[model samples]
Target: MKNASFGVLLALQFLTRIPIPIAVPWTPDTRRWAVRVYPLVGLMIGSVLTLIAFAMQNVPAPITALAVLSVWVALTGGLHLDGVMDIADALGSNQPLARRWEIMKDPQIGSFAMLALVFLLAWKAVLLWALLAYQAPLWWLLIVPGLGRWAGVALLVLTPCAQQKGLAWSWQQSLSAQDVALALLPLAFIALLAPAALLMWLTVIVFVVLVRWAMMRLFNGINGDMVGATIEGGELWLLILVWSWWQFATVSPPGI
Candidate 1:
C-alpha cells in the first residue's frame, strides 16, 4: 500500500504541475508502478476540469470553455504540447528519417510547429465551447483524460523506443505485463460507471492502433514525443466523438 501511494505521487509529480512535496524514490520498482498508475493521474486531471466546468455553469459557455482550456494547459505544464510541436516540426521538415529525428530534437520552433499548435488549441477550445453550450454529460470530462493517458501507457508499453536513451526508453524497459494489466483497472471502473462510454473507448483503441502503425512506419519505433502526441490526439478525438454522439444520436447521453 505504501509503495502504491508513492507510485501515485510519483505519477502526479511527473505528469502534472500539481505540487506533490513527497520525495519519491527513483527505483525501477517505483518507476514501473508509476507507469501503472498513469491513468489515475489523468483521472485526477479530468476531475479538476469537471469541477471547473460545474463551477462555471452559470457563466457564458465560451468564457467557461476558455477557462477550462487554460486550466488544462496549466495543469499539464505543456509537456504533451511540446511533443506535438516536435512531431510537427519533424514531419514538416520533409527530410530523411534520420534527419527528421534531428529536427525533432532541435529546440527551435518552426512554422509547422506554430501552425499545428494554434490549430490544436483552437479545436480544443471550440470543442469545449460546443460541449458546454450543448450541456453535454459531465462524465465525458472525467473519462477522456484518463482514456488519453491510458493510450499513452499503451503506446509506451507496446512499442519499442525510437531513441536508444531517454526517459521513454527507460520507461519501456521498466514496464512489465503485470503493470500493463494493472493499468486496465481504471478503464474497467470507467466502464462500470458508464457503459455507454464503451463506444468512445473503442474509438481510442482504433486510434492507438493506427497511431502505433503510423509511428512504426515513419519513425521505425515510438518515442516520448510520439507518446505525448498520442495523448493529445486521443483526448481531442474522444471529445469530438462524444460531441458527435450527442449531436446525432437519437438516445440521450448515458447517465443523463
Candidate 2:
C-alpha cells in the first residue's frame, strides 16, 4: 500500500507543476503503476481549480474566468497543450506521414499550432466565463478536469501506441485491461454524485470515441502527442457539454 501511495504521488507530481515534499522512488514498477493514478492526479487538479473559483466568487466573471484558466494552464505547465500544438502542426503540414512526424518533432511551433492554441484558450475562457456568470456549482469545476484525465486513461487502454519507445509505449506495455477497468471506478462514483457529472461522464465517452477515430485516421496509431491532444480536446468537449447543460437547465421549465 505504501508503494501504491507513492505511485499516486508520483502521478500527481508528473501530471502537475505542484511541488510534492515526499521522497519518491523512481522505478520501472512504479512507472507502470503510475498510469492507474492519472485520474486521481486529475481530480487533484480539478479540486484546486474549483477551490480557486470559489475563492474568487466576488470577482467579475471574465476576470475570474481568466484567472482560473491561467491557473489551470499553470498547474500542468501546459504539458498537454504543447501536445495539442504539436499534433496540430503535424496534421496541418500537408506532408507525407514521415515528414509530418518530423514536423511534430520540430522544436518550433507553426501557424496551425498557434491558431489551435488561440482558439482552444479562447473557447475555454468563454465557457468558464459562462460558468462563473451562472454561479455554477463548485463541483462543475471538478467534473471536466477529472473526466479529461479519465478519457486519457481510456485512450491508453483502448488504443495501441504508435511508437516502440517513449512514455506512451512504456505505460502501454505495463498497463492492463483490468487496470483500465479499475481506473474507471472513481468515474462511476463521481457520476453518481451529481446530475451534471452523469452528463460529463457520457460526454467523456463520446469524446474518447471521437479522439480514437481521429488518431486512427490521421496518425494510424497513438502517441504521446495524440494523448495530449485528446486530453485538451476532451476537456473542451466536456466544458462545452457542461456549459450547455447548465444553460438549458437554467432556461427550461422544471418539468421539461
Candidate 3:
C-alpha cells in the first residue's frame, strides 16, 4: 500500500508543480498505476492547490491562476498535454490512418497542433481566471481535480484498449475490474463524509460516461491519446462546472 501511495505521489509530483517529499526506492511496479492511483494523486494535488490559493488571500486572481497552472505544468511534465497536442496534430491531417500515426510521431508541430494547443491553453487560462474572478469557494477548488481525474481513470478502466502495446497498454493490462473497484471505493467514503460534494462526484460520473461513449465513437476504443484527451476534456468541463456554480455560492469568498 505504501508503494502504491508512493507511486501515486510520485506521479502527482511529476505531473503537477506541487512540492512534496516522499523518497521511495523505485521498483518495477512504481510506474504502472495510471489506471489506479491517478485520482488519489489528483485529490492530493487539488487539495494543495485550493489550500494555497485560499491561504493567499492577498494574491490577485490572475496571479493565483498562473500559480496553479505553473505548478501543474511543472508537476506532470505536461504528460497528458503532450498527448493532446499529438492527437490534435494527427486529427488535423487529411491523411490515411497510418499517416496520422506518422504525424503524431513527428516531433515537428503542425498547424493543427499549434492551433489546438493554443485553444487548450486559452481555455485553461480563461477557466482558471473565471474561477478566481468569481472568487470560487475553496470546496469547489478542492474537489474539481479529484473528480476530473477520477473520471479519466474510470474511462481507462472501462474502455477496451485501442492498441495492443504502449504505456497505456501496460497500465491497462496491470489493472483488473477489481483493481478499479478497489481504487474507486474511497470515492464512496468521501461522498459519505461530505454529501455536498455529491454534485461534484455526480458531475464527474456523468462526464466519464459521456467521454467514454464519445471515445467509443471516435476511436472505436481507448488508447493513450484517448486517455489523455479524456483527462484534458474532463478537467476543462470540471472547471466550467465550478465556475458556473461559484456564482450561486452562499458564502462570499475572500478574493471577491
Candidate number with greatest lDDT = 1
Residue 147, candidate 3: alpha-carbon lDDT: 68
Candidates sorted by lDDT, best first:
1, 2, 3
Q: How close is candidate 3 to the true structure, as a TM-score?
A: 0.81
Report the lDDT of model 3 for residue 165: 79
When 2 and 3 are scored with TM-score, the better candidate is: 2
Model 2 misplacement above 4 A: 21-28, 252-256
The predicted structure with the larger TM-score, 1 or 2, is: 1
My TM-score estimates for the predictions, one after another, are: 0.94, 0.92, 0.81
lDDT of 1 at 58: 91
**Candidate 1 structure, TM-score to reference:** 0.94
Cα-lDDT of candidate 1: 0.88
Write the residue-wise lDDT of candidate 3 on 93-186 in tens digits: 7676667777777888878877887898788877787677776557666666666667767787788876787766766765666666655655
Which ten-residue region of model 1 has the weakest summed lDDT?
A: 247-256
Q: Put down candidate 1 lDDT per residue, 19-43, tens digits, no spaces.
A: 8888998877788889888988888
